[model samples]
Target: MRLLRDLTNITFLELDVTSTKSIASAYRTVENQTGGKLHYLVNNSGAGFVMPLLDSDIEMGQHLFDVNVWGVVRVTQTFAPLLVRAKGTIVNNISTASCMGLPYQGMYCGSKAATRLMSETLALEMKPLGVAVVIVITGNIRTRYQGGSYFSSIAERIGVYARGEQGHPQMEANLYATKVVGDVLGGAEGTIWRGAQSTIVKFALAMIPTWLMNQLAVKGTGLDVMEI
Candidate 1:
């Protein structure tokens, strides 16, 4: 937040991801401010919620898709002209959840999976235009965007228990928090600008078959059938 405030020429536009008009207006504002020239577009806005696939509310799922999938598309499409002109780079802030499926976070993972495919396709498409496209697959970060108090309220309302286990829910939440903190400390700067090794690992895992990937995910997360 302070970064935005500190930047002199940077303009912050508040727009709803679900609305095309909002997206268009934001673009117009940028163009007006910068005289139709732009550089370095970073798509970092997204939303997610932690809930089981079955019990996940339809509205929450839709909200996640709106912000995570359509939002990136909207922003990218709107700002692409500027990027093309500048021959600049587009950095999409993706997530590790795009590859590894976690328990009770199905909605978030599904949205990110969509984003991953979109990013991949866009990278190929934009290659011809001399505009570089980079998808930053991040692990986690200590941010309030993870629905802080809202998650607790939702858990309380839903009566948190997955197949007669109470501690599992608490453990899942704690693990998520711990990982987020670790990632922040480990230098995730809203993008994967460093640590190229992790990026290679993610790409390798993504190339694996679905069945094998699922097995690896389950095993890696320690979420065997007996545990879940």
Candidate 2:
């Protein structure tokens, strides 16, 4: 936020994507500010949890979906009219976890996966109206997200058996952030893989046979100890 404050043209608004009232207020503010046309909307609000399925509560899972999946939906739905008016672009930031079931990140993975599919459908829906939707399939980025997910602080403990082969290259998101804006400005749409080795990781997961992938998953996450 301090970074955004440094910019003269940036208008900062506190928006809670999970709250309809907050979204509505933000919509009214942006609509009035932009004269009822918004060109770019990025659904990037995210929440993370680091726990095994056994340790996860239903409420915890619901909260994850609320922030990660439903948050995007709510934001998009509210801002879509403005987007259509401007024939704008919508960028939805997702994660590599969308495609894989990572150890100790059950609901996080599930929420991202849901976001991925929802973004795809949104793209199709927006295209006819000249509103582009881009789904950013991001990998690991070193930032508050790590802190948010407790990936380093908490997941490190619960994930002890889950870190077999390693995942993500642990990156600075600025590299992809700027690239994505450039790509969107250049008319890129659909899915753009970003973050360190994001494409390679997704490809590897896709190409690996199910059995071998299972072996890797189990051995990597140390779940192989339960092999019968």
How far in Å is the alpha carbon of 40 misplaced in model 2? 0.8
Model 1 Cα lDDT, one tens digit per residue, 45-110: 888676657767899899889899988998889889978887767777777777767667798889
Model 1, position 180, has a per-residue lDDT of 42
Q: Per-residue lDDT for 1-228 in model 2, tens only?
A: 787788889888989988999999999999999999999998988988867676678898998899999999999999989999999999999998898787778888999999999999999988999999999998767676553432434455455434422553676768777877888888889999888878787888879986776566556454544322
lDDT of each: 0.67, 0.82
Q: After superposition, how far is residue 118 of candidate 2 from its true place, in Å?
A: 0.9
Number of the top lDDT candidate: 2
**Regions of model 2 farther than 4 Å from truth:** 147-168, 226-228
Give the residue spans of candidate 1 off by over 4 A: 147-228
TM-score of 2: 0.88
Residue 166 displacement in candidate 1 (angstroms): 14
Q: Give the CA lDDT, 0 to 100, for residue 192 in model 2.
A: 92
